[model samples]
Target chain A: MSRTKLDLWVGFFVVIGMGALLFLALKVGNLGGSNFTDTYVVMARFDNIGGLKVRAPVKSAGVVVGRVTNIGFDTSGYRAEVTFALDTRYQFPRDTIATILTSGLLGEQYLGLDPGGEAEMLKGGEVVQITQSAVVLEKLIGQFMFDKAAEAPAN
Target chain B: MNGLLNVVRLLGAMVTEAIWRTGFGARFFILLLRHSGQSLTRVHLTIRELYFSGVLSLLIIVVSGLFVGMVLAMQGYETLQRYGSGDALGVLVALSLTRELGPVVAGLLFASRAGLAVTAEIGLMKTTEQLDAMDMMAVNPIARVVAPRFWGGVISMPLLAALFSAMGVFGGWLIGVVLIGVDEGAFWSQMQAAVDFRFDIMNGVVKSVVFGAAVSLIAVFEGYDCTPTAEGLSRAITRTVVTSALAILALDFVLTSLMFRGQS
Candidate 1:
C-alpha cells in the first residue's frame, strides 16, 4: 500500500511538472495551444522589415490579434513582403494600414494594424494596400545631420 | 631557510597530488558513462531515486520560485514606475525567471537538496564497505547503484526548473496584480508580447538540462571517489554541493552566450 502511494505521488509530481512546462510553452512563450480557431492570411509589403522575425505578434492598438506567419523579400521591387495569420474573429477594413513597429526601445519589432475608414471589409486573398516600413534610426539620424548641414551654409 | 624550502616543496607536492586525484576522478566518470546503459535495465531503481531526488525536492523549488518571483515583481514595479512603465511588470518578471533566475536558482537548490543527499548516501556506503560487498557478490556497484541516481538527477533537474519558473510567474502575478493593483490584462499580454517560445523559454529549458547533467555528474563522481572515512564522507557531500553550484553557474554563462549570441 505504501509503495503504491509513493508511486502515485511520483506520478502526480511528473504530471504537474509536465503541466507547468506545457503552460510555459503555450501561454508564457506565446507559441501554440490556441490553433483551433480558423485564421485568414493578409499580405503586406514594406521597404524594410528591420529585424522582424516570423512569429512576431500582430497587434492592433496594443492588443495582440494575430501573428506574422511568413516574410519574404521582393527582390525586383526592393521591398519586403509579410504574411499575417490573423484570427478570423477580428475583421479589418480593406484599406487598413499595416505598419511594422517596435514596441519599446531596443525591443522586438511587430506588425501594428490601424483600421481605415472603409466600408468594405478585407477579403481572403487580398493585400493590405497601405504599409509603413520599419523606422531605421541610423537613416533618421543621417537625414537629420544632412538637413542640419544644409541649413548651416545658409545660416 | 631549509625548513621554509621544505614547506614550499610540500605545497608543490600537494598541488600535484590534487591534480592527479582529479585525473583519476575524470577516468572514473568515463567508466561510469560507459556503464550508464545499466540504468535503463534498472528502471525500478531509477524511478525510486527520482522520487527521492525530484519529487522530494519539489517543495523547495516551488517555494523559492514564489519568493524570487514576488521579489522580482516588486523590484520591477518600482524600477519601471520610475520610468512610468509599470505595466510591463509581467514582461520583466517572466523574462528574468525564464532566462536567468528560474533554471539557475532551481539548479542550485537541487544541488544542495538532492545532489548532496546522493553524495552522502553513496559516500557512506563506500565508507561502510557496502559497495565492496556488492562487488564481492559479483555486482558492479557503478551499474547497480550510481547510474540510477545519476540518471534520476539528470531527468529531475529540467522538471524542477520548469516548476520553479511556473510558480515564480504565478507569484509575480499574485503580488503584482492582486496585491499591488497592477492591471492583470496588461501583465499577461505584455509578457505574451515580449517573450518568444523558441528564444526565451526554450533556451531556459536547454540551460536547465545542461546544468542537470553537469551537476549530477559531479555528485556521482565525488561520491564514487571519496576517501572511505566519516570525515571523508562529510567532505565529499560538501564538495558535491559546492562543485555543483560552481559548475551550474559557469555553465549558465557559457550556455547563455552560445544561445543568445546569434539573436543579437
Candidate 2:
C-alpha cells in the first residue's frame, strides 16, 4: 500500500476514535449539562436527609439548577449539612426554603428550593436558614396511625 | 509409583518454566519501554502498525458491538416493560456498554484479531532468521520492529474500544426507539442523566488502555521468546490469545472492584 494511503486510514481511525469519545462524554454522559456554567456553593442544614445521596439533583420548581456536592453530618448542630453547587445564573433570596423531596412514591430524593420574597439574594457559601428534612415514610405512616386511633373514640 | 512420580516431576518442570517465562517477559517489557523512543521519534512506523492492528479490526468490533447492544435492548425491554419502565432501556444499554461490554469485548476481539496476528508475524520473522540478520548487521530488531508494533496495539486498542461502545449505544437506540416504539425523549434523557462522565466513561477508557498495554506486551513477548520452529510458532500464537483474554478479564475485575467499591 502507498504510504499516503496508510497515513490517511490511520488519521481517519484516530478522528473517529476521538469523535466516539466526544459523543460518549456529551450525549451519553452528563458532561454537557449545567456543569459548564459557573456554580456557587450553597449550604443548607437538614434534620434528616433520608437517602439523599451525593450528586443528587437540586431543583427549583422542578427544573434542575444544581447538584448535591456534599452530604455530611453537622456534629455541632445535630443536623445534616448538605452542600449544593447551584448555577450562578439562578439566584434565590436569603429566606428561600430548601426542602428534601422525592420524585415519586418510590424514587431517588432531591433537594428542592422555593425562592423567598426577601430582596437579599443568597450569596455563595451562605446558608439557607429555612429548611425541611426529608419525610421518612415509616414516620409519616406511624403518625397517621396514631392520629387516627386518637379520633376513634370520638367517632 | 513410577507413574505418579513422573506426573509430579512434569508438574514441577512446568511450574519452573512458567516462572522463568514470566521473569523473562517482565524484562522484555522494561526493555521495550526503554527502546520505545525510536518508534516514537520515527512516528510513521508506529502509524503503519496502527493501520494493521486498529483500522483492520474496526469492522469486527463495530458489528459485534451493534448486535450486543440490540440484544441487550430487546432483553432489557422485555423485563422492563413488565413494570412499565421501558424507557430505562437507554440507561441499561449505555451503562453496560460503557462500563463492561465495551472494554472487555473489544479487548477480547482485539486479542484474537490483532494480537494473534502480531505474534504470528514476529514469530515468522524469528523463524526466517530476519531478527538474526538484523543482529548481524548491528541493527536492533527490538527497536526497529517490535517496539512499533507494541505501541501500535496499545494506541489502537482504546480507540477501537471507544468506537465499539459508541456503536453499541447507536445500536440500542435503533432497536429501542426506532423499532420498538420506546419514548425517544426518555431514552436519551435518562441515559444522559445516569451516565457520569468521570465515573463511567473515564473508567472505561482507563480499562481499555490497560488492556491494550497488556495484550500488546504479551503478543510481542510470546513472539520474541518462541522456539524457532513451525510447531513452536503455532503454540506461541495460541498462548498469546489465551493469555491476553485471561489477563483482560482478571484485570477488569480487579479494576472494577477498586474503582467502584466505595461509591453508592
Each model's DockQ score? 0.43, 0.68
Show model 2 residue runs off by greater than 4 Å: A1-3, A40-45, A72-81, A90-97, A116-130, A146-155, B1-15
Which docking band does candidate 2 fall into? medium
Error of 1 at B97 (Å): 0.8
TM-score of chain A of 2: 0.91
Record all residue pairs in model 2 with backbone atoms less than 3 Å apart, i.e. clashing: none
Query: After best superposition, candidate 1 residue A107: deviation in angstroms?
Result: 6.1
Clashing pairs in model 1?
none
The per-model lDDT (C-alpha) reads 0.88, 0.94
RMSD of each: 5.7, 2.9
Query: Which candidate's TM-score is highest?
Result: 2
Model 2: per-residue Cα lDDT over A1-155, one tens digit each: 45698899999999999999999999999998746368999999999999898888899999999989888888998999999999988999999999999999988999999999999999999999999999999999999999999999999
Let me know the TM-score candidate 2 reaches against the reference structure: 0.89
Residue B169, candidate 1: C-alpha displacement in angstroms: 0.2
Candidate number achieving the greatest DockQ relative to the actual structure: 2
TM-score of chain A by itself in each prediction: 0.82, 0.91
